[model samples]
Target chain A: MKSKIVSKEIHLKKRPAGFVTEDDFELVEVEIPEPKREGEFSVRNIWMSVDPWMRIYMVKGSRIMPPVELNKALSGGCIGQVIESKSDNFKVGECVKANFGWREYWAAHDADSSAKNITKVDPKIAPLEYFLGLLGITGITAYVGLFKIGELREGQDTVFVSSAAGGVGSVACQIAKIKGCHVVGSCGSDEKVRWLLDELKVDYAFNYRKLGESNISSELKRACPDGIDLYFDNVGGKHLEAAIDNMNIFGRIVLCGTTSQYNDNNNTSTTSGNVNDPSTPTLSSGPSNLSLAVSHRLRLQGFIWSDHNDILNEFNASMSKWINEGRIKWKESIFEGLENAPKAFVSLFKGESLGRMLVKLGPYTATSL
Target chain B: MKSKIVSKEIHLKKRPAGFVTEDDFELVEVEIPEPKREGEFSVRNIWMSVDPWMRIYMVKGSRIMPPVELNKALSGGCIGQVIESKSDNFKVGECVKANFGWREYWAAHDADSSAKNITKVDPKIAPLEYFLGLLGITGITAYVGLFKIGELREGQDTVFVSSAAGGVGSVACQIAKIKGCHVVGSCGSDEKVRWLLDELKVDYAFNYRKLGESNISSELKRACPDGIDLYFDNVGGKHLEAAIDNMNIFGRIVLCGTTSQYNDNNNTSTTSGNVNDPSTPTLSSGPSNLSLAVSHRLRLQGFIWSDHNDILNEFNASMSKWINEGRIKWKESIFEGLENAPKAFVSLFKGESLGRMLVKLGPYTATSL
Candidate 1:
């Protein structure tokens, strides 16, 4: 068989100020590098993830992760199949996962090459694509932030999740439900709300956008009549304020993410007219009623999932069982090819994806087949 | 023996709009109620406490406790001597602590009563007045917030306390120092700062008012170059913001009180000319940099010591030993008579008190004396 010699890569054209656009990214073709060293392998990418955290990586010096440099291949989580190998650890047609995404082809040596990261995947447990969403870091994040960091108790606590239809939030919504909590989810669209309420069987689901000019505080109060006990906050700003106001005594606010305040003005929706004014992005300055936290004896903790890798085995065991038993459900908004990878990433901040937004890079190749 | 029939009380004239004042209180005389039923006793008030928490009670519908009703005598923690007893549990001249403050006389039977609450005080352990300040709830609050809620470790963690010379704050600062932490403190006045730095032996102390026009954020950065690990927050607003910004990874903020935000405008010092505009009280709306909490993995928890009565015995044993050994130091800002109680209460908001503020109503009366 003839070896594929070319790879098309997506590059970060410029550092984005607020919302990313098509001009911020570029698609370029180059000859794939040969793995000259011993214990080297070459892989053709299949499934890639476009997560909200990638947006954090784009902002220079804002987070712990090194910023994605300009005019370079943007790296992220991806699933691929070995096309060629010089290492005993990898074989041709073997499926694997790596942090070498936003590209059509990758050439590397060993499991961890500075150029391309690789980890062998077990397809017998679940579909190859499921590893990118449900069985991936996204699901792990949901499990850790909800149960571990949030201190969610089954059958007792009430949970409210913002961006409930998004990747981490959707999984968080179902996990709280499975744990026997009174689950309330806030989504941006009516369709998302319906999916969360009907499909996910969340106890309460509201389209925060449909609430109109009225502030989210009153709507949140009406939505959660019993008051929020554990708030898994993905979207900050008004959602945070509303959560703080409606929290019960000794309520715990798990600061997982702040998707709403990604822009300077705190505007998440791209269709909204306010995007042009980058100078005066009308973001909620902060939670105005933080003083209430004192009287109510609330705890607001912010954490990242990578710091909690010890729970991975437990998460995998429970999540796999839940998936097989049909106790858990997941949805994906898929994009085709490396060309649309930037689009998928941008769509996250715009609330365009109903579930986990991903890009299909190439078809899975199996040695068994 | 002649019975004193008349009792003087300070009544809540009205819920003040923002900051409390002399106009919001009135001195009135009423007949001291006689213990008519068995298990009832009458207490001649000796010492009453004017805490920052009492300010929270004055605010209409702000806390779990019923707001001090307009035109009614405001109640709080107080120490008194038994003048008459119909109960075998108490005897004449026995000193007791109860929630019957702002009045010169109190009569009740049970530990918790609608009119008065009485708990027998062991005066032999320390002075009778010590129960109102150091050996009582104020000291317990500092201990619980510093060690329990804040999870302070002795030499490992760097501690920072706001209102560092106030009742709870001063005790918290000393407790942290005894625990062997490098301590930093923030106070409202130069005298308070000197007291914290020189007398208390805190590693760093700053008069927040002296930082003038400059934000607390920069001053806090300079004060805590190593970064704050445990924060006992009494003053909120800018102090909270500064603490949040200067915190190290996994930092814990014990939200004991928010004396700075007692006024809607967050103006704590009455002597500072910044209080002119009732319209704009110059409060940092909320911590604008709460996102930093997420990056640093911060835990901000608000709590009261009453919820942690389980530790009172331990607190008393440790504190009494510390006091007897002279390892612990304390200061008292005393105002004599029931009439000066309201003025003392207002002085708390004004940051006029260097340490625990108490109003002495009458001389201690122990039969053993």
Candidate 2:
């Protein structure tokens, strides 16, 4: 049966070539269906997250995860309220977070999927939008990359983070600082750099764009005079090289996202080529100084936050405590409607967003109290 | 007092720019002095080890270790018989292994140096030369890299080892096979491939030189249909790229040596360059597919065997047991005389050696019996 509620969703019009343009996405309108079957529930999304990883989903046949199908509503992190429920698992008016983003409304059966993907989030602990930012996957990504993968040495490690003003990076910077590490952050703009230094209180913050990619290694060496013990890599091209250059012995490099390479056309070429073929230069080169990993006894590890779902409860507890104690702070750059979601996602690569980039679909009515 | 005996020694003539040659070294003759001071001992060198890591020592201003001082006698792992002793710690005619290679005779105070560097070795524990090869650092290197660093899962892991007929790689192959792992080995020649398949009895053996660098990934995929669970990387560059492309989820890569890059002139440039400089292509490129580490959740770790000397006794126990059980085997390409040491060293990069390469100065005199 039709609920008489209209939903606007963003769909992939075409796969991106290099950098994503607004034309790559198409906004489609549809009617929201009422939940009729048992264990089925409908959500009216209040906030949707725009992340860099979504670009991977836009590519055809990604080895990491299945690409988003053509003309289908794109999926990501979203915070919504249960508007219709036929399931005992979800109650109407309860705030929840799910991977049904880029849409105004979503309908799903609780019994059809694992509970790990969708879960109830309390508005009393944090603002509803925070479930899409600091208290959500963004915060968990930082925690897992630092503690689990990077093996951050509290009060001892000198940590360097690239794309420090972005969602995961900003949280990573603050978390490293809170853990008493000497934190250095690199960002695209002076404003972001200022926010990293003044608000996040990072030990050092530099505008990489101003310095240019050519001087990244020297600038990183200058900022982290003692050398980086742990590098939280977000921008992976020149930034990764710079991190490799300035890394100390037994350093740990956490590969989170290659934001710098995401938009590069060269990165999409999956075919192997002859080593002597000069025309196929992109196929042969990565970080030039990777040989240094041997002499320095370094470790480079890559991980997806969702792979560590068993630690969600532990992460939530720590994050909640940090939020309550004023040890953690977050910033948001919000777009007004679902139609602006594509613009928000594109803004991430452009360095236009301050921290967690989000799209607001509707107002959230507090259900915690 | 000077003895009547004259000793010949090999000294570094100059630091090598690209590949090492005989001209980089010089032979010198000197008188062998008697041990005059208390706690002093004299040793007559018999066997000297020529290793790939020696290339790193020849480069000027290496960050990994102190470069060999210009015009000085080259020092390395050597098995020797004590000719004379004034120290209570050592007795004359006892066989000892020390880092006093490249010389016919060496004298030092036992009190001035740590005992870790010099210790009496039993000839009964295999052969005296075995202390410089399999039962020595070579065996320990493979043991530490597989069990300690690579964390090999016995009977479960599909292991890939590059330079499989070389010193450490041969030992690594046998150890993995003994542990019940399905092993794949890549070497330079058909003869070495035959040895790997026949004697080493690896699950798969391929001549990488015949396969060509460009085809390494496809060939590796064909050999390891299930994907590589652990890659003991000795030859870097294309071999590393191949391993990355064929790596399984949560795969581990133990970075032992970069044999392919040791002679590379591009590797010595420590200066940071502009990311856009076309002339500086060597400074910017490594393994183009390193980003796969993110999607596959792979980890690449670099290590040196000496750093783990704390487990020497444990390593000796295991290796001795393996040798007695006929589970371990080794091959040696020996060059006679101290003057041929330079030739033996250069032969390592040419892939001329079948297994552990050595320089034989004299024969062992069965001191253990």
Candidate chain B TM-scores, in order:
0.87, 0.88
Worst 10 residues of 1 chain A by lDDT: A272-281
Q: lDDT by residue for model 1 over A85-203, one digit each (tens)?
A: 78878878888888889998888878465335466778877888888878887788789898778999889989998777777788888999999999998876788788888899999
Clashing pairs in 1: A265-A281, A265-A283, B265-B281
lDDT tens digits, residue span A1-369, model 2: 544678999999999877778999999998888889998889999999877656766885466557789899999889999988899989898888988999999888988647647888898898888887788877888999999999999999999988777778889999999899999988767887788888999989888768877798999889889999999987566788889989999999998743423323233342111111101112124677777787788899988787898888999999999999998888777899999999988776654446667889999876653
Error of 1 at A283 (Å): 5.7
Off by over 4 Å in 1: A1-6, A17-19, A28-39, A86-93, A107-118, A258-283, A346-351, B1-6, B13-26, B33-38, B52-56, B111-117, B258-284, B349-351
Relative to the true structure, candidate 2 has a C-alpha RMSD (angstroms) of: 5.7
User: Can you list the residue pairs that collide in candidate 2?
Assistant: A286-B286
- Candidate 1 has a DockQ of 0.51
> For model 1, what TM-score is found for chain B?
0.87
